[model samples]
Target: MFSNLAIDVALGLIFIYLLYSLLASIVQELIARLFNARARVLTKGLRRMLEDDDHSGDLGFFGRFTFFNFFYELGWSVVYFFQPFKNSPFLKQFYQSPAIRYLGENSAAARPAYISPAIFSQTMVHLLRGPHKDNQLSDADAIRECLAQNSLQLSADTLAHIRDLFEDARHDITAFRLLLEAWFNETMTRASGWYRKHTQAWLLILGMGIAAAFNVDSIAIARILMKDKSVREQMVQLAMSRQPQYAAITDTLIRKNVLHRDSAFFRTDTTWKVMVRDTSLIGVYGMLRNDLGDAKNVLGISRACVTDTTATGLPVVRCGFTHPYQRNGWLIAAGWAMTALAISLGAPFWFDLLGKVVKFRSAPPPNTTVTGE
Candidate 1:
């Protein structure tokens, strides 16, 4: 039902999205490494569950300013800008407690990215039991007593909720522990949602940045592919030739091994541990430089300078910061926005779509039997 030219153009666009999405993923991984994103997300979720104030709006004098006050009211305020985590005493203590204190690489500073439900139960039980010289009260009874006395400074709603869970468990310490684990697991599902939402925001920002840097205007690219028969043919050939390589990259086993330093490349069985050790941006880009070079060949995108002969037959081009955006600024911006949105959908999505499109193009047309309806 579709023309060959249309299919080829679609292939070229999908390939572009696939390449840029992979690049954006690498950048996102680097950012996650630098910020300990997983660990922070876990801690944030725990703080919210514990009803601990993370100093989200503890902005002292600045909190009086209309601008800061506006953000505070909008629920987009920050924590620890002026005052430290003074408002998060319980959370600070929980992290510093014996059960959790040594779980991370930097025991004194970093928090663990993952905390099993069992470990969470253990930590909660230990914190609830508190310090008693005699240790007279059993774990469940101690937690109940603490809640009754408001020793932990927990909110009335949290206190009532835990008390109900305890009652539902029939005050049996084992059952209470199980119930606690179940509750923690349920809360973590929401935590994962929080992480996903923030990650998408970061991906969008990275997509826009990469699209602008590379002049990957999707609209302009589609126009070029539609009008230039030679370029379309070349792009189709390029896509067909590189299909196996892209497939390998997208394979589940290979993707899982990407960040493992000692993992060997499955295709060549070669080691890349040495290459991964260099954390510099140049070193990181070097790992994917070959694919990037191929992507640069996609038509309608330009880098560096272009030369042309004037009416006098003299070269009138200088090699400076020449880019395709110098002309048709609005069109180029629109293209960049479109490309960015596609890239944000991610590498796997585009690659899978590319395979389907390629298959449809190659498959024989549906049977056209002349049977009467």
Candidate 2:
């Protein structure tokens, strides 16, 4: 029973962390939207490819048009279903024409919001080749002429790499395109790493904020759960009830709105449209409320477990807010820090740990009675 109780406490703590992490993610997304962080990062990356130190002029008309169009179209497609942009009148107006809407729907499968190296290479090649000028020039000359005309700058190393590829491909357009795609893939990989690093930094900052707001002190919660049998039992039951629904809800969210490759968020397909209609935090909370009763009941359990109080009344339990100047201030700070760090581990990590703990709780107890001879 003690072992089972300990597992329950661990699971409860993990569940709280997971919720905090999800809230942090939602907040981070909101911040990104408010600041247009994605567009800014994308523009910075594109500029590196389109501008050179030596050729410090604005891109040619065609170059500007192609790049800006790509940015606008990709931005609309990616963010159209996100909460921050879903109801934009401008996007609605842009897609009002049936023909344009149909084209957008059809092309969505081929164009993810995140610009890949392959996509970049393909777009660049198409722009460089231009309209109705197919067999007019060698691939190498066409690439060089396109860059020169656009006043685009490339680093010395990148220029040398392209020249080497041109020689190796013997100016074969297809071969050159493939080489460029490979090079672009490498570049995008590095860019992705940078993006992820910044995202983690944002998540950590948000996690700390959420921890403070919720007063999620891990040490206090652990002590309360270990000592209070009733609270522990109630929490374990709540977790058990909530665990089965977690995967279904999360999977639906990913399939309908989160995954870039899925592209189901804005599809005209009736089934997909129905599935994505309620892909919001409120929707998920509603589902939980329907299954587990009031969402506040669950939150109350977590709050009661972590909150520090000074009451010395009967049925006493240590939980409630603690001030930094209090006698145990350092301990409270450590607990808050631990909670914040757990949230930074992200929701999936806690979900997995909760699953394992639940399985452990469900296992049959060991037999202690000896068999009669």
Candidate 3:
């Protein structure tokens, strides 16, 4: 009844709104880019101040893209990160944990968390030993053995979960050290059943981690903490709601699988622990298990020595650490390299595959090509 004149006026108003929104978005992007540029410039300057003139331009790239790095470079970075088992995968997780943001990609700490654990541990060692920080002994070979023996006893699937745990920590690897220490101290003295101690510790750490994640000003913590559980649940459900082709590889690692290491850590009743580690606590648990019973099967890793049995009650916990299918440096590198190469070389095909995996619901069909105009 109002005719096309009314429609014309409405279209004009819509166009004006669109223009304003576009301009605002563009300005916001420009300001963000400017800030990023400034931060990178300052980062370069600061490193030069502390380290050797950073003679290698490649170091900056390594510094920047170490996480999500291809297999070979990642291995080297892991080596340079820690002198002990730089050749091993532990370094990758250690360095990459302090500031990782599994919940948010854009966080600053995410990059550091991407670094290998070897680098972070070594860096800590250097700072501590450099006549300025703690005077920790450099007997990393012993420490590596302790952790290695411990890690090897774990099941392959359990090791996979721990690997994911490292990525999840990409926003806050530093907290790992505190938590790891807490794990040792708390694990040793607590008289409660191991499960109860574990429940309490995981809850405490998860609560703090989630809290930090949501505090906007906190570098390690992002906003995921404040989000309603419903929101987080929905987000996770949304991601996993799909039946992707890659689901086969992940099926063994899913939380509820009996063989999955996380299944044991989670089978507990606490809500906080269930959510925090989600499905990735097997990092150490699977390794600690010494018994494979008739009923069911289930798990330090450190570089320090404790030969003074009288002085220290136990330099090493009795967790068995001898058996597992070991995939050392070369094999590990080749596998990751294959994955990267697949995605990089077949990016378009992968994108198409991804599209198939996520079959998004469609909107209602448009009324007309010209619309209300």
TM-scores for all candidates: the values are 0.76, 0.63, 0.17
Q: Per-residue alpha-carbon lDDT of model 3 for 1-373, expressed as tens digits? A: 1213322222222222222222222233233333432222222222222223222345566655545344545464345433422333433343334332241134652322122233323443332223332455343333333234543333344344433433354424455444333333332222123323333333333333322221111111112212234333333233333324224323422332211222232122212222213223242223212111100110001122234344557554443212221114443334333322232221123333334323321223345344575
Candidate 2 residue-wise lDDT, 1-373, digit = tens = 3256668788777766756665665566556544555434443344344433122123446445666665654565455325322433322332332322333223432112245454455555655555436558765577767555543334454455656776677777778788876765565555555555555678788877766666667787677677777767776777777787776755554564431222311223322242234247567655543543332244342433343345664453566543332237677678778877886665566777888888877866677555698
Clashes of each: 0, 6, 36
- Give candidate 3 misplaced runs (Cα > 4 Å): 1-3, 37-373
RMSD to native, candidate 3: 28.0
- Show model 2 residue runs off by greater than 4 Å: 1-3, 44-112, 116-118, 130-135, 138-140, 144-151, 253-279, 285-327, 366-373
Superposed on all Cα atoms, model 2 deviates from the true structure by an RMSD in Å of 10.8
Relative to the true structure, candidate 2 reaches a TM of 0.63
Candidate 2 global CA lDDT score:
0.55
By lDDT, the candidates rank as: 1, 2, 3
Q: Where's the lowest-lDDT run of ten residues in candidate 2?
A: 258-267
Cα lDDT for residue 197, candidate 1:
61
**Candidate 1, residue 336: CA error in Å?**
0.7
Q: Please give, for residues 166-232, the per-residue lDDT of candidate 1 as tens digits.
A: 8998988788889988888777777777666666677789999988887778887888888889878
